[model samples]
Target: MHPTTTNEPPQTLLDLITDVLSLLLLSTITVQSFIGRWQVLRTKLTSLQSSLSSLSESPLWSQNPLLHTLLPSLLSTLQRLLALSRQCSSTSSLPGGKLLFQSDLDIASSSLSNHLHDLDLLLRSGVLHHSNAIILSHPGPGSDKEDLVFFIHDLFTRLQVGGVEFKRKALESLLQILNTDKKSASLVVKEGNIGYLTGLLDFNDQPLIREQAVSAVSILAASNDESRKIIFEEGGLGHLLRILETGSMPLKEKAAIAIEAITGDPDNGWAISAYGGVSVLIEACRCGSQATQTHAVGAIRNVAGVEDIKMALAEEGVVPVIIHLIVSGSSAAQEKAANTIAILASSGGYFRDLIIQEKGLQRLMHLIQDLSSSDTIEHVLRAISSLSVSDSTAQVLSSSTALIIHLGEFIKHGNMTLQKISASLLANLSISDRNKRAIASCMGSLVKLMESPKPVGLQEAGALALVSLLTARWNKKELVRDEKSLMKVVQMLDPKYELIDKKFPVMLVNALLSGRSSGCRKRLLDAGACQHLQKLAEMEVSGAKKALQRLSGISLKSMFSRTWRE
Candidate 1:
């Protein structure tokens, strides 16, 4: 230092002191910045912990009264704090990011568990007020899933024990649960809760609760068979029956659906009829709602499957009611009513005449003319098939050229189902000599339809009808066995009517074996009917052996008679 001379300049004490003070100031600034950040983070964590702890202890945390006042504000604050923590974590790659996320999740889970515990306690203690308080607090769009589940379980449990007050609360809670999840609504039904809920059917004082209970029971009944039986056992049928008798329009409508579910069991068809359920269901068809009327008709259809059940309903004037539903209700109602009538008419000629006498024919004609409803058209065609071919129907069909013309058009343009029905109706029309002549006038068109590329079912029906007319004694001389008609039948037997080809040969053998008409048997035998039948017999098809037996009889008889003459 002493040797260092003029080349090196010496530092002044003030300069050194200034440098030291500047270093201390920088250090202090650094320390203060870190302290401020740490304090902010620590404050956040403390606030979160306090909120978590206070979630259970504070009176505002209680769901009874204070929660209604504090829940909205608390949720908002929680959301804001979570957002701030997320933002802070994103800005820095510090260890606090993971810690903050875990803390948030843990706090949320703990809070949910605490709320559930509180609801459980309220339920166990039978304090519906507090339970409802918990529910009300959790209201609004963004409620917690786990909390909702817990609340519903508690409410249901309380409903199992509590009386009217708890029932009211539970019913309200059930509405919320049903609105939340259909599966949850189904779960309550699965747990035998339907029995307890349906017990409220006796409560006339609270129509709202009664309505809700009925709605719940109906939902349960629709899901499965067991719940449906529970509804019947718990007087649900009786309540619905009474409602159908006395309830307002809306109640009657719901009751109709409920009754359908209950009576839909095929096993209960007779029981339903015995309990006057059929009459009630038929009466419900008179209501304004098309849905109600449709359901009512469907129930009647179910019950009508049983003979005694149908008779009971018929005695109660079900046919007239269904005819009214068909004519006056909506198209859908008309379709359902027609379907039920078809089922009723399928029983026999008695219902057929009844349907026609009750102006069901007019209703069916209306449906047939309605192009808007394909279902209605289909059912109308079915009704036509179901009509009896008694003398009265034959007379009407013969007199009404419009009806025959309409049926002819259907035979041409309708679906396979409608075509089959039309074919059957034509067969019925051809049963009488007068109607046969009426149908014979359309033989050209009938032959065309029989040869069309439509379903074999319709063609088969048409062919049989034509065969009957052609084979009739009075018309046989006038009938033309042209080559084209014969070839069409042959083609029907070869490929299109494989399953029913055996019946074709049988019919031919029968017609030939009749022996009442001279030259008919020789004509059929000459037309390869014998060879075709012998070929079928070798294939071992049913009725083939009978055909062979018949052929053997003819040969043996001819041989014996020839020997006797010799």
Candidate 2:
């Protein structure tokens, strides 16, 4: 048994050597495969590093147009490389996923910021197209939250540059963001971007940008007194005046509105005037564009409300300019011109006659005839109301048959506001004897209108006209034949309807207290108007009480004056 075992053992040595050789061969193959994979990965990493280095060195990477084209592609490549690296490192148990993701994020963020910096440079250099830049800079729909915030912050920072194109894009972006998300606007302003907007008025180009900027400025100006102070401190007034002087019609229009916002408070009026804003605005009135002229005229009117500005504007020949604008300008221009004249006429007592001498009365009469717009008619009526109060205007109204007919036609219109204004103008005209005669000639038609179910306003107007007519010396003869029309006015004093009840009694009291003539007083008393007035004095409240007091004062004055004259 021992000899047989020795022989089997001896046969095994060669077989053992062959098995060890086979094992060594397999291990070598495995090592070679791993080395080849490592080389491939190292080559890839080197290639990526070179690409990154090249990207960092290129100035174009920061340009908005170039970067806009490059960023997405770069981000995609980085993401893909990161995923591949993560997969490759997974089998090795390396911390590659988090590291790769963070590196990619950091790289992408830095690149984006750098690209935005280039856009900012372009904006500063005044080379970029505003609208295109805005489109390029805005965050895409699926942009990461952090990236969006960074993009917005960077865009806001660049807005301070003085380029018109840049400002347009920035403003467009701001407005768009504001429209979509107010929170973003709040954030933008919170970061002191408002100062940049205020600075934009200094730029020489881009009126549209300035127009848009003014809207934002108005919003910020309304926030508080402190913000308003900032607006002024930032030279907002001077810039606005410059725009008024040099900018286009649209720019001037917007600038005027902005100036109004800044000067709206009574406290700021003197400051605004002191800054030469009034003179600048007056000059803007001479612009060729109707809109610009209208806005400028409106601004001047507002400034005229301040006493010093009014004197300054009058000294500057603003009245004549306004008259010219009205006489020859378009309908809108004329409307604004009339408003300016009205403001001047009210402020400068001597200016009304001047306006009439300038044919302002004739021009306004023409507008009243030709205007179909309710708003234009209303403006013209108001101007007429102001003008008609003057003696010079009374002469014009008395002679113009067309004016009287147009006013009567307007009274029949369905708009209550127009009817009220027409009535007011007629009341002012009735101050003159000739005006009273002209109005009395229309009494038959007016009485019918008063009875119409149009509105309480027309009734009030008709009643006022009747009072004027009955009170006028020459006019009373015309009404004497229409005893029923006179009696109808007395019947209106009964106070049945709310409006009729409230106003009719006061009018009766007024007529009895101070009739247009002595015979007018006698006729009203004979109609039992005194009894109606006495009843009203007892029942009136608040405004009605005030009206009764006025009636009493008029009656007392009339009695004393009559006694003195006797």
Candidate 3:
């Protein structure tokens, strides 16, 4: 009889048989993608070359006096694109060469987009929409900053007086300049440009013109504290909200970012919330594109830091949407969502319990372990520290070996915030025996953390984690033998410098002193901790005094005076 065959192959067997199909599909996709891009690139490059060659004769462009300011940038960008395309052609056959062609394609595409964007900005900025009278009135070029200001002001005055000629090309050009040059953005804001920028956002203004104006306003607002204060006082935040509520996706995105940046000032948070800004931001986070959602999440991050706004965000039912984005949003959006969650989770018990109830931690755990980005990890670590404040959540999170290992590894991270948060989380996990054992297994990492070079603020957290590991009792012998770790703990006892909170280090030494292996006490005495402890005793720190007396078997009454005893 023939043996019967099963319908499903074993997983390894199935995977082994897939190489032929996968390789063919990959080659087909790569070849098709490169071919399509190369054709498009060649077509665009040829057109640009033709345009540049005939620029001296082109009527709409070269023959027009008004096109003077736009020609140079367009010419330069075309030349650059032509050069890059040639480079791509040269690199197409070598090892890892497709990446170069692909990179060239991307750069050329974005450059074209930015150029087109500039053209559109000018067209929509009211420059081309109005009569030739203003076009002919254009001043050729300014000799200095003051002349530039006068040129811009003349256009603003024309707009203000509600008469005379085309949309404010002069003002439009200045805003576009400020958009690209940050230093000049500050200067424009300093020259009192807010009134005119806001005028561009007037209810009757074209959406496109208002859009670019909003962008310029946002750039200026980001320049400095004084600029933000100026924008905020000029009702700039309200105009931004109006655009966010009523404009195109591009305008909304810029407005959301501006609203978010402005709210970084502590004074504006409640005002934004009062404008129903939080509700709108939550909506954007729910349905906006990846880029929009990134900006929206950042806005939420800033607004939600205010207790009122954080609570309002929760009331709008955003947590579930945020959790969804954490699971499926683009990488940039995910990082922003992580920060928002971190802030919300720290708000209070209700937010923490809700996040746990929604399985937010599971998604956050995936982000932390999979992304391995330092910023994401730091934010997730902060979220975990906040969520773990609950004993119920602790019992669950404490079992993640991946998380514990990351925490231990982060102990030596370059970012002090991350190191301290890692230490704090490790300290929390030490409360559970399972986690305590996990931490004890990573004993060397903990010791290394204690020896961090920037020891300031590190000890407040590092000391607690040290105490947890050393207090495991089963692990004390190995921990005490680590002379670097032992000496670090000893060094923390010096009241001469406020290295860490005296309480944590004192508890650590007391824990170590109890049930000492003669080796442990000798480790302390040999590390010069006895002298540091004497200094603590004379300063009337009881924990240090008792630990010192136990170590040296000496009376303190005669050695230290009453004034020093407290």
Each model's lDDT: 0.59, 0.58, 0.65
Q: Which window of 10 residues has the lowest lDDT sum in candidate 1?
A: 1-10
State each candidate's clash count: 0, 0, 0
Question: Candidate 3: global Cα-lDDT?
Answer: 0.65
Better of 2 and 3 by TM-score: 3
Candidate 1 wrong stretches, greater than 4 Å: 1-133, 136-152, 160-169, 176-186, 287-289, 348-353, 371-374, 431-462, 466-492, 495-498, 505-566
Pitting candidate 1 against candidate 3, the one with the higher lDDT is: 3
TM-score-better candidate, 1 vs 2 = 1
Q: Which structure among the candidates has the greatest TM-score?
A: 3
Best by lDDT: 3
Q: Write the residue-wise lDDT of candidate 2 on 144-192 in tens digits.
A: 7665555555465446532345556677776666555544544555545
Point out where model 2 deviates above 4 Å: 1-152, 160-172, 175-192, 204-233, 248-257, 260-268, 428-462, 470-498, 501-566
> Model 3, stretches more than 4 Å misplaced?
1-143, 161-165, 190-193, 202-205, 431-457, 491-506, 525-540, 545-566
- List CA RMSD, all candidates: 20.5, 18.9, 25.7
lDDT per residue for candidate 1 within 1-566, as digits (tens), equals: 02212222212321232243233233333332234543444444444344434444433323343233223333433443344344443435535665775566456445434433443444343333333443333334566655555565556655554445656777777776665665565455554356667777656888887877766666667767877887787767877777766776777777778878888888766777666676677667765377778777877877777988888877878888898887777776777787888888788878887898898876676556654665777777777666745676666655666666666666666666666677677766645555555545444445555655556565567656556655555444333354454444444434235544456535534533443544544445445555565556556555544554464455645644664696
TM-score against native, each model: 0.58, 0.54, 0.66
